[model samples]
Target: MELIQKVLDQPVAVSQPASLRPYNSKLKVHDQILCGKIMHSNFSKLAYSIMQSVGYVHDIRAVLFEYMLL
Candidate 1:
């Protein structure tokens, strides 16, 4: 069987908290918004940058033969 990526790497500091483990479970967080934080996670920041930069430059249509392209 194929293996999937682990969500978190080994914690770098001995003082890492238990709450950090909960941050690795992503299926629980899809499509939800984050509010009122001093800073966001790096992954979340990259995602927002991608969405803002390349989000709506393509169009989709349906016909006898339908397809999606970018």
Candidate 2:
């Protein structure tokens, strides 16, 4: 009861909601899935690039393949 009273006593601040008119929401399920897969692959690529930058001789493709196998 005290918590509820405290919450009610606090002043409420309202912010304008974001407008999403510029975004596309009609994407297919397969497209969304493919986008997710690409995003994951990009993360691996980024890791591979970081590894190469740090002088690791490991093959990125091999590492990515092993990741897929799991």
| TM-scores for every predicted model | 0.26, 0.29
Determine which window of 10 residues in candidate 1 has minimal summed lDDT. 56-65
lDDT of each: 0.26, 0.37
TM-score for model 2?
Answer: 0.29
User: Residue 43 of candidate 2: its Cα lDDT?
Assistant: 42
The candidate that achieves the highest lDDT relative to the unseen native structure: 2
User: Model 1, stretches more than 4 Å misplaced?
Assistant: 1-39, 56-70
Q: Give the winner by TM-score.
A: 2
The reply for model 2, stretches above 4 Å from the true place, is 1-40, 59-64
lDDT of 2 by residue, 1-70 (tens): 6644543444322122114223223222212222344344444444444444455523443444445559
- Superposed by TM-score, candidate 1 places the C-alpha of residue 27 at a distance from the truth, in angstroms, of 16
RMSD of each: 15.6, 17.4
Q: Could you tell me how far off, in angstroms, the CA of residue 18 lies in candidate 2 after the best superposition?
A: 48
* Candidate 1 global TM-score: 0.26
